[model samples]
Target chain A: MQDIKEILWEICKAPGSPGQEGAARQAVKAVLEKVCPQAVLNDDPMGNLTAFLGDKHSQNQLLFDAHLDQIGMVVTGITEEGFLHLAPCGGVDRRVLPGSPVDVYGKERLTGIVCCQPPHLSDGKAEKVEPVEEMYVDLGLSRAQAEEMVRPGDAVLLHVEPRQMLGARVTAAGLDNRAGVAVLLRCAQLLGGKPLSCGVTFLFSSREEIGCEGARVAAYQVQPSQAVVVDVSFARQPGVPPQKSGSMGAGMMIGTAPSLDACVTSRLIALCKEHGWDYQMEVMGGRTGTNADVIGITRAGVPTGLISVPLRYMHTTAETIDCKDAEYTAQLLAAYVQEKGGALDG
Target chain B: MADLKLLEELCSLYGVSGNEGPVRQKLCDLLTPFADRIETDALGNLLVYKQGKQRPKTRLMISAHMDEVGLIVTHITDDGLLKFATVGGIDNRILCGKQVMVNGHYGVIGGKPVHLMKGEEREKAVAVDDLSIDIGAMNRAQAEQAVSLGDTVGFVSGFDRFGNKVRARALDDRAGCAIVAGLVQSELAYDMTFVFCVQEEIGLRGARVAAYQVQPQAAIVVECTTAADLSGVGAGKQVCRLGEGPVVPFMDRSTIYDREYYELAFRLARENGLLCQTKQRIAGGNDAGAIHVSRGGVRTVSVSVPCRYLHSPMGMIAQEDFDAAQTLTALLAEHIAGHPAV
Candidate 1:
């Protein structure tokens, strides 16, 4: 568990923005090599990495995927007062950005604070919130010094660290996906001696925060018969519909979509029941908005299933998740892979 | 004549939006010689197949729409001019004074002369209702002889080369049809399905049905896109330039391309020394709108020829760009056919 926590810590701290996911790629690659030493690590032109486990001659192939990239910042311009104008690499809530601390990674590292006009400087009453365009980051440096440390196109990440909340709950930045990646790593480590009936491939994908770009390439290259995309789903948060949100410590959530093959979902459900694991159902009306949407359409079409870890405040600097839920997800995946022999019936 | 002679023959065939029998028959004739099996779907999409020696490791579907922008005659005026509505996204501004062929019959558009217009009316572009087709008919009886109500009409023009560029009507997709035709003439290693789809000008109706039926592992759409590289347009909004080779879209409004497929295309373009540009802006939809969502889903990519004044009677495109698109598509087909699913 401590090793898994360290892996998560390292991954969340890495800076990888959309279209510029090399840093996260290197971090994920280092961890993947440590767990699956014999696994082949190859990156497609899209920067998607596929790590293969077990023998190639295995009759069936199962692929598990988790996107490596996280939401961050790209410096679009710099103001004269050492403030930085930034564009979101992925979707970011502009309202929460003000007063948040960020680490700008350009030619060198620099810490900055997101600032807006103080109420005293504004007209007696203005719009309560400003658009992201009007916002800027103050690095507490002179214009010349800030310009020397950071330039346009440099990446920046939230200056937040992982902290254990209420015993089982953990709060961190980028738990939206790095937690899923940690689950895959832990699953790989747990299933070492247990003989697998089929070949398994683990993919720590890149560029998913922007779009499912990495999953698109990994699925095409692997062309697996069966695919499982592990990502984070929104949990029960304040003002969120109770029915729609998955419970935080209630266990793993299985996605149900018209695009998701019924047989795959049922098989996963049956596996969870067989293993006596706590599980819940999530209904996806149209698109799953995960890698499952991409993997389901690859080539002749692959039957895909999704296992989600419940997280609150997704796509934010202070995203929160329960560590037990992540472990349960890993356990569910390991059980499904080990007991996936019978003909899949919807 | 070069292979373009075949292309010209294809372009000359009349296949307006709803009625595409003439174009379908012509494509069938041209594809029969090169295909192992040729068939048509319920929506009139032409599917031509060439089997490979190996049990097809991958099923590749290459598509180009056969339908061109035209007008469907809705009413005939008492003065013998034909009142029509456009079947696709037609620039109403270009409708006046343009010559159109009604279902292969020659005609000229008749509308109010510029001198007869009132204040502010002259500044505004002509609407569809104000324009009508004149086929030298004195009455409705005489107008029925040359064309009829509900008859489809399109620009009656031929391709002409000026320097390295080619100007023509309906190049919005006839150029795409020609590229697919060129690929069919080449040797392919993987089992290939060439679809000359119909009704693409309207809403990609034919592509939707074709993708549902073929259920291909991967698809590549050959298309002609709007080239806004004119003098007035700014650099950021200049969608494409003529003779800049084929343009591959990274993200279009309709679909975001599969990253692996997009990377594979870029790598292939680099290795072959072919000139290709990525669509920087996400605008316009194509057959990919249907191809990306068909069945479970397909890894899809689009290669387009940059054309000026798309959806107008006189669209212009560079022949070199068309040729470049054809060469790259053929090369990709060969590479995928020989290699594994990756």
Candidate 2:
């Protein structure tokens, strides 16, 4: 069996910012092709890749959604000195931007650094974080040379290698959603080559960072009786309240929100208990901040549930998670799909 | 030409301020083969004397620091987080969300996630005091097993070359050290003393002591100074620039360099057809600060490579400028050693 960490590292290494999801989409497809080769895979106009398994004609079809896009920047303009100005493609955190390294996908891949004022030049006081629009990316090239290589609207991703930390924890730039994508791929690995009563369709949706457009469009086409969205949620770190976030290395976070299907959430919790697997409760008052919020209201209002792998340092290059959490999340998902006669009524 | 391969190897070694054992050991190994005598002082400075074809009329000393700016673990929180303080001048804005290596373990400096931050907090920069290094430890006991207090933390950056520029950590002084290393490996015209001093970042403490020990008649401090030629920054604020060759400063925040040596640097560069520039602003200091003020004072001038993003995880320098700094330092050192006292 392919390790989930290996799968996650491969997926996170691929750069896919919002509308530019081709690379990440292909990464997810490669994993699925290796683990679940019997499943039929296809893409939609919006770049959403769907892998279908089991009897497609079954009335009780289930869809799993995970975003393939990550937060990054797009080149907006270039200065006379060749520094490239940028606009955030998603909700990029301004605080962690200064002095960060990035990769600009231009005519060819070029390494760039976010311009940061050296302390010697500053007034030695805590300065306000500059908005991404005001910041520039230094390509270490002259104005004329930079213009020859890079252009406006080129994609730029914060460049940090996938690093294995102590124990099961790992950190990477695209771990925000790649962790979820890896979970779905592992889930497919478990359910592959096995007979199931209901059909399963895994949707590696695109452009979820900008909006839930990919999930919204893909759900309308699949029209499943029930859906579950797997994405990363807040993991407990310093300054984050315990009630608002789950602990890292704990387990899967079974999300409970007003927008979710209660039956599916309960079923997932029940399966975790039955299998002696660990999990934590993620309670939300209103809509869960995931693609589940959009997929639930798709078509004639499909009953959608949410599951998240606890992640820390979101929207930055240091997004971290435990590889064990992803494995357990996959186990819960596989158990949910394999339960006799998979159908949820809300 | 500057040896980029040597510079890359030197940059990869960790040598934060007071914790410069690894850097000192490496330099000793590289210089031992080419030295007349090699000895380390109590303060960990690698003092090497190289005999040449002829003894100089004036005793000359060439200096480059072996230390780089980094962080040190100050405290370990009960939750397995490590609190650190900057060992040297580091921009607080660049501390967050950066990968670091504390001792041998990989860790990341992070604070509250942006989604959890409220009000003006999202737009405000995090102070170094508020950040912590998380190495995936669960509690204080687990963290203690992996790291200890006062452990040096170095930024994890790999050497990269693109176009005419090279980027890596520790380029500030490592580039300077690489230039001196090249000279030590070559044939010289006059006897000279080379001192790779320690803890220069913490206040030029190492150079201060080394100068007192050597007490040369004239000194040449090879360094890498800040070049703020960034986009949108005004030309007046750009103290120096890359690809402009070596920077010879007249006066800075630290020392008013020797008049004769400062002029001599520019004249020598012009005579040799080397690209050279002067710092446009009186900002930033180096070992020249401490070395020039030693007992009875020594005539010292700084010949530096203009570097961008100095004291940060990644610093950039033009290859052409690096080559120029290396050649000019060799030429300037030879002239100073052979010239008679006026």
Candidate 3:
């Protein structure tokens, strides 16, 4: 099996601006083909990529979901000067946008730096965060050159490389859902070694950052009886209260919320206990803010569960997570699949 | 032309102000082969005396800073988060959500997610007091084991060139340093002194002492000045512009530059058919702030490359401007050294 860290870094490196997820979807497809050869792959019109392993005719199918899209900006206008006027495509953190470097996917791949005033140039009195639309991108190009090379609808992504930190921790710009995508990919790799008794469908949905549009449509197409959503939740960092987050590197966070099926949630917990794998409880009041909310009500309502990798600095270029937590998440997911496959009575 | 490869190497090294040992050492190694006499000053300034064929009538010194702005660890929190204070003037707007290196370990700066911020909190930038560097440590003990109270933190950025531009961290003075180093390697019209000063971002502390020690009759401070020719900013507010040319400031916040040398710079650039510009706004200062006032006064002028977003993680400069700055600095140095000013 490929090292999980390498797989995570490879997926995170691909740009997947929301609603323009072709690049990221291609990366995940290549890895899925290598990791699980027996699986049949399919792409829906809504931009969701799905892979089915085992008998597609079975009614007892298990669905796994992870969003492939990440937050980014799109070019809205080019100024009379060479600067690019932008509108963020997803929940791009305005606070981090200033002075951040970006990669513009246009007629050509152009490198740009978001415009910002250093304190020496500004009034130096009140510090304010500019709205995303107000900030301009400087590609170091002339006005005529910019218009010739770029259009209004090109995608722009934060250009931070995925880096390894101390131990198994890693940092990258698109770790929000790519971390979850890595978890699902690793889960498929583990499930490939065993005799699958139940059909499994992996859904790498699109555009979860703006809304669950892709998940809502893709889940209806997959039509699984039960589903599990793999995504990222807040990890304990400074200023974040401990109650609302899981400890990084502690384990996978098995989500418990009102909208989640109690049986799927408890079964994951029991499997964690049986396998002696590290785990944490991520409790939510109502709807877990994940694809679980949309995937649950798909076509007569599929029962869905949530598993999250404890990540720090979400929706920014500095999103970080521990690689071991991904391993823990994959272990719990593979265990759940095994428990469900045993019930097939083959 | 300036040595961009050297500039990239200089920018890649981490040498925040007050801890410029790494940058100073690199400069010393690069300049030693070209220098007749080189030694480090008390405040860590690398002073090199490159000998020419014949000594000129006027004493001359050309200088650039060796230090860049960065963060220093002030305290490690109970949860292993390292609190830091900016070593120089860094805007609070650029401090959040940046990746940094604390004592050679990879760390990231972040605060509460935007989803957790309240209405007013979202409008205002996160103050430096609220931000901390997370280096994947679990507790204070582990953080203390990895980092100390005074370890410096530098931004982690890659040097990249696209179109007619370059982007990287520490380009503020590294571009200047590369220009000066490149000059030291070339044949000079007259013998001169080259000082790569330290702690320029905090204040002109290093240049102050180096000027007092060198006591040259004339000085030229090579630097990277702010360029605010942005999309929304007005033309008057644009201190200088990239791609227009090198900048010669008649007056900035720190010094009223020598009128004769100031005119001399533009005159020489025009005569040589090189693009040159004057700083339109008197907003920034450089080592010229201190050098022009050292010991009965030195006739000093500043030649700068107009840079966008100075003191941020990634600063930008036009490749044409960098080459022009180097050629202009050399021409000004040679002419001033031969002039009968002393």
Candidate 4:
């Protein structure tokens, strides 16, 4: 087995916060290229990198997608006390800002902590937990020192390292879709040296944390007969309700949503059962909350199926997943591309 | 001092709603020695059962939430500032200029200084959208190295006593947790279930599962209700007053306490020579709101220590009110155990 932890560390450690995905794109691109050297690689205008494998003219074309970007913030202004004011680029939560460690990305990398005036200085006048707009990042620098280092447009991200936890779980800040990307790479690696009847497009999408822009662009360009979108789903834990999510280390989540192609989804679930693989059902009454939603509707509508690894702490620094789940998702994807029939289930 | 120390530790521990591992562990360690049977539910509700002096068909559940309101990291900016959202209900006003800790690192919440705000901005409170948590990372990668999206952060406030009042973050429920702990030290007349629930700040999350599983005939929810008896606030709207006594609210948004249990508490308080008071206003709700409706319904009442600035990092409470609430809750549990109305 490939050292999945090492692969995830390289992918997640890249600073790929929404629009700022250069490092992540470059890093994941290297992995894709290494895994499928014979595959034709291309990048769309939306920064969706695709590796084309197998025979392109085959009537059946399968596109596999994993978004590369994660949630982050944008620096909007600077305070006289050397603190930087920020705005959220995504679904930012304010309750977790106090004393958080961050870096001001600009001309220089300066380490700092998120702080405000202490209680002694506020005279009991501070309002209840302020919204994100009222928070700031203290660089531990003088006003002059801060202005010299940090630019207003720079981005900040969770300062965390990935770790191998007990029970074969891996945790980090940006494991949401990185876990998906890892699965995609593993599938490509599996199919690299094989002759296949169907074409496979492995897409590492960007700007997914904000929206499914990359997947949309790739879906339109690839114009495939079928697609499988991989992402992260809430894992059952202490606070989350059991019925609402799947347990981490249990199995992969096969999504059933209005936006997903029901036929393709059922076929995937049937495949899992036939193979005796660990799988769970996720019925999203509305949005599937992944790139599949946009890809399912792209260019005359492609049949899209969704697969998500059960992830704990979805958008938090401690986002976690079971390595076995990632490997299982890869095996399914690899088998999916190789299978041929008039219909996916057939 | 010893009792106050426990309250301080509970409030200081970072047990944000949905992330109550620390508080749960502490309570589990504390309760293991005395509890006859203890188990943690899927949602992290710690259920500790103690067989009373006499066996009874009806079981009494005493619940106090272990989770507190905090923030979760949503975005880390390129300039290394953190953007966040409140995990529970928090007024935008109390967020400016506060110290906090994420994971274990410390930072501050900063916004525009009053000196810099112009025109309309100065007239109103700053919108949360404009705030940022500066953790002193030099760049996006540097920040990402320490913090991660969705990492839970807590206020840096610690439990402290000044004069006759105690101030701390999470006193709203930590005070209640302390009360439950105090009750555990006393003898029970009937079998009792002590449930410390989670995610109450977001909703009555953990208590729902606990109530259904225990299915107690009667439940007494120990909580810390809002005490807005500050100067300039109207008397009718004060809701509750610190230093008076524990507030026994007749009704709140989530529930109306069992009429029989409501009247029983006051009668027992009088007989026991305890000073008990009714909440001046029907306002905030607690786990009782959920417990009363769980599994075909459980009879429930809420007894809260009056807390000022309920959701902020620094909530204030009267030490006397804390003591009184502890005494009253313990008494109510013993009463429910002895006199089974179920």
Candidate 5:
């Protein structure tokens, strides 16, 4: 309802590669400032930004977190043919790299194509995807010219424009997480005038794609009584099994884990049902693989829950999500914040 | 008297698997001054106790295993070579042509020189049976003087501190022991029982008995975990990193952590500003496998120092991570003492 596609477009376009997330941080900060002026914003040593809302004297603190960083690449070397050798900032599936166009962020923005030898040139084993080290990006210039435009340590983001597909499905690069960031922003906007009984800290963490490092620091710093980590879960797609993945456009996914606090989970499920929101449940036998992992064991430990937005083709260009599902996730969170105060404290 | 020097000395001592007398003695000597009561279990586990200010409703158990994976002498040849078998899980690939000391004795693991192997054989890992200990002795009698059948030998290595990290053999559990040692030296509010467990390399045999003896209501297993944060591994698969902080296992293959206790730790960490990360992958089991099920099932949580190349010689760990775990454990102990919830 709030031009969610446009918000997703702006966020998905920002170049934020793991440890270098300043640009994305600024972009998200601008949106958050406009929505929640009374919110307390703080950045920890690890570059995780948290915006606190509601009354500070509230007995319960509910932490809502979504990472602001996206998976990209770092320039490692320049080939003699003007190709840029790049190292992955996060887990970049090598099979997706060869034909992908990327926006290289250096002194100035440069466009490059990630390229490798074609099947006809090498042994049939060339079909077997090689490591990122064996791949390079071509910028269509001589080595000297390419070197003048880009240097080592430049960031490279996948080049893809956000597109609104049929109905509410949206497609773009980095939608695996920027959708989550967009949800946090939307939730903060909705909570502006609502009288809340609990203190809510909305964390726009950095470097979650690399490791849950930013959330780790922020969790230890905020030390909230309860935490809910909103992240992207693998969605059911062409090759993916529905048993292991959630369906896209099927609302939000709630995680059940051996690590997840059972009380928090039960309360969240009840809240979702009470508010008549579409939600699915995911059972994680071991690790939830989100900021919940760290937030669950920060100082002593904090009871944490995970809410996932189903995503297709994660950690790749053209990551896709359902806008309706994103909106329902934010609505569920806003409703949960209003209802979670008594249950969490008691 | 020197904690760092003692750590180096303890690390350098050779006592692998079944033959851990030298390491046990070193720990006993170091723990003697700090512990109010000290006793060794039948399985060679060092149980050190420090009484609290009041009658403890909960006995806090802290454990670190002493046994490290090494080689055991299976047969001694008439011509001074010793055939051995692995005492624990060892990647035989890294075993060929490495320096080793036999149960505080001078010896070296000997294997065929690279020049002697030909063609496809060079590509294959050297078999354990193809390796032996060479003490530069001519006959069985000379070999008997320095080594014997069933003699245990480990990588004779000293702890080396570099930048912010430390590399050594047996830091996996030795670092845990040093943390327990540090705790014993501090003024604790709870009745603390630190178990320097043995035979853990052989499937947590000592911790089972030690847990039975202490029967703590809550336990914190401070040990080392595998740090696979390196090149070539996917970011999602890098398990943990060095210097990031202590790797706390929310759920591992062995135990599902208590949710309340887990939250208690996270809350305290956030309050104290400690650096910590949750274990992202279900990989290995630890003493928590037994500690969680001890007696009526004690509530257990594990805080591990992330170490690279576990179960091998030259395990690397971040020193700050070890310290963070120590601080968190100490803080946890104090918290439990201040608030009796159980």
Candidate 6:
């Protein structure tokens, strides 16, 4: 087994808030270069990155993918008091916005905390959730100083570093996607210089959380015949229903949605069983709520399958994912590719 | 002043979102005389790219939604009354007892006459689910023949003029459409693209795709915004007032405008000697929500005509507000033509 703790740490630590994804994209690109130096790499006008192993041939398995853009705020306005008001790039839990520490990326990185109403000044009402409108960040700079350095449209990220949890789990702000990115890199590392019939393309797409826009354009550009999307799913946690959540540390979940390509998905399940790998089933009544939804119907259509890592507290700063599950996912993707796409082409 | 004849044509159209084909054809014919380059995309956004007489510095996109908030057919009862759903955000209180156009068949949305209401139902606000459209059909068979399931339904209101005031349905944006149509005829100093976008009321879908396709450096969305300047309304609560020129919003629910762009709009208004009002309260959104974030972000702001009782069958706007919207859009384009900042 390879130790990828360092790689995952570097990916989760970089701030790639929505439109400002250069930092995270750069970090992921560096790792891809180191792991698969021979693989052909390319990026689209929208900044969607892809790494291709094997020849660019038809009837192959293409990765539907995950994005590097994380949920954070963009500086929308600066108040005369030197405080900044923000617009959320993707999704940020409104309950977590008040009083949270943030790093605003402007001309220079500015450390600040979201200002909140103190309870002592309240007038006898129970603590109620306030909308994002009432929230602002205090940078402790004068108006002139802030104007000299920062401008509107800058990004602000939650200041939470990845931490080790009990039982080999990890928690951070962007584990919803950075973990998926880590799995793809590890898969490439495992598949380095291997002889294979399957043409595997890893799409480290951008702007997934805001919408499936990044992959929508990528799928349209690539137009791959077959695809497998990697994303994050809800894990068993407090206040979560058992039917909706998967067990952490079990394995990655193979999505079972009516919209998903049944043959390709069943093929994945068959490989997991044959290899004695840990796996689970995630059933959706409609869409799987991933990039596969958009990728499935791009152009005429692309038959797509989905695989998701189980994580708790999605979209929160403290998103938790078991590192073992990520390693297991990487092994499964690499083995599934080596198995000649599990009889779908046959 | 707005040409009442042109305003009449715009306000009386049936251009609901996601189904703008008929409206697009008519609009194309009207713009063909002025448009240097006109093309429609897969998602129904009509891009009318007009080049400048001089060298262009920045690409400008000025847009207005061709779609209006309307109804979608959901179910049909045996009595031929259709159970319907709203296509965009619409208050249920304004829906009851209003006339509607469902796929060419005129009908009336049925609400329990207050005299027929029983007990608490009289005291409660009417919900949309409780309403049905009566198209004078005797049975499900006749209703199906004229209007099939999944057909779009829009409010049925005709344009009327009363002392420089106009009231009509879809004026929320058809008013914006007329303003751009006039701008297309005038000579331009800077190259600009005028987009008639779709599905904006459904959440800026057309603008999102169109902005990506064009990748403009800056954009201005001409729209009609709500005016809550009714009698007894508090100062901090009124969003804007009708007849107060054009309302330039600083921020709204879906977007926060670039400070420089909003200020630029105000500056153009000041230089042109046109009346421009700032929104008193932050509320509704427009295509700026999606346009500003498309393709590495764009500088976008909105110049809206103040509308009273917006998104309804009887929305009202002043002719002078329409004139102000036209002036603000022209001056902004003219100013950018000279300054031309990225």
Q: Per-residue lDDT tens digits of candidate 5, residues A120-140?
A: 222344325556777677564
Q: lDDT scores for all predictions?
A: 0.74, 0.90, 0.89, 0.77, 0.75, 0.76
DockQ of each: 0.01, 0.77, 0.71, 0.03, 0.01, 0.01
The DockQ assigned to candidate 1 is: 0.01
For candidate 2, lDDT tens digit of each residue in A1-346? Answer: 2389889887988999998899898888888888889889989999899998888888889999899899989999899899999999988998888888889999999998898876666665457887899899999998899999999999999989988888888888888899989999998998999998889999999899988899999999999988989999999888789998999988889999899999989998989899998899999999998999999998789888899999988887678898899999988888888886477642
Worst 10 residues of 1 chain B by lDDT: B108-117
Reference-based TM-score of each model = 0.49, 0.98, 0.98, 0.52, 0.50, 0.50
Best by lDDT: 2
Task: Kindly list the per-residue Cα lDDT of model 4 for residues B69-113, writing each as its tens digit.
Answer: 889999998756699998987766556546668877766565432
- Over B1-342, each residue of candidate 1 has an lDDT whose tens digit, in order, gives 115666677677778888888888988887899999999888889998887556566678899998888888988776456889999876564454445677555565543322234555544445677667665454677677767788998765555554465656677687888888877877666678889899987888999999988888888999988766543245666677666788888888788987877787879889988888877556677998888799988788899988766776556677678888888888777666565565
Please identify which of the two predictions, 1 or 4, would achieve the higher TM-score against the true structure.
4
lDDT of 5 by residue, B29-146 (tens): 9879878999998888889998767656666788888888888888888756688999876656455434466645445454332223455544444567776765444457867777
For each candidate in turn, give its C-alpha RMSD to the true structure in angstroms. Answer: 31.4, 1.3, 1.6, 17.8, 30.0, 26.6
Which residue ranges in model 3 land beyond 4 Å of their true spot? A124-126, A340-346
Measured against the true chain A, the candidates' chain A TM-scores are 0.93, 0.97, 0.97, 0.93, 0.95, 0.96
Comparing 3 and 4 on DockQ, the stronger one: 3
Off by over 4 Å in 6: A341-343, B1-342
**Candidate 6: deviation at residue B315, Å?**
50
Ranking by TM-score: 2, 3, 4, 6, 5, 1
Tens-place lDDT digits, model 1, residues A43-71: 77887777776656776788899987787
lDDT order, best first, reads: 2, 3, 4, 6, 5, 1
CA deviation > 4 Å runs, candidate 1: A1-3, A124-127, A341-346, B1-342
TM-score of chain B of each: 0.95, 0.99, 0.99, 0.97, 0.94, 0.97
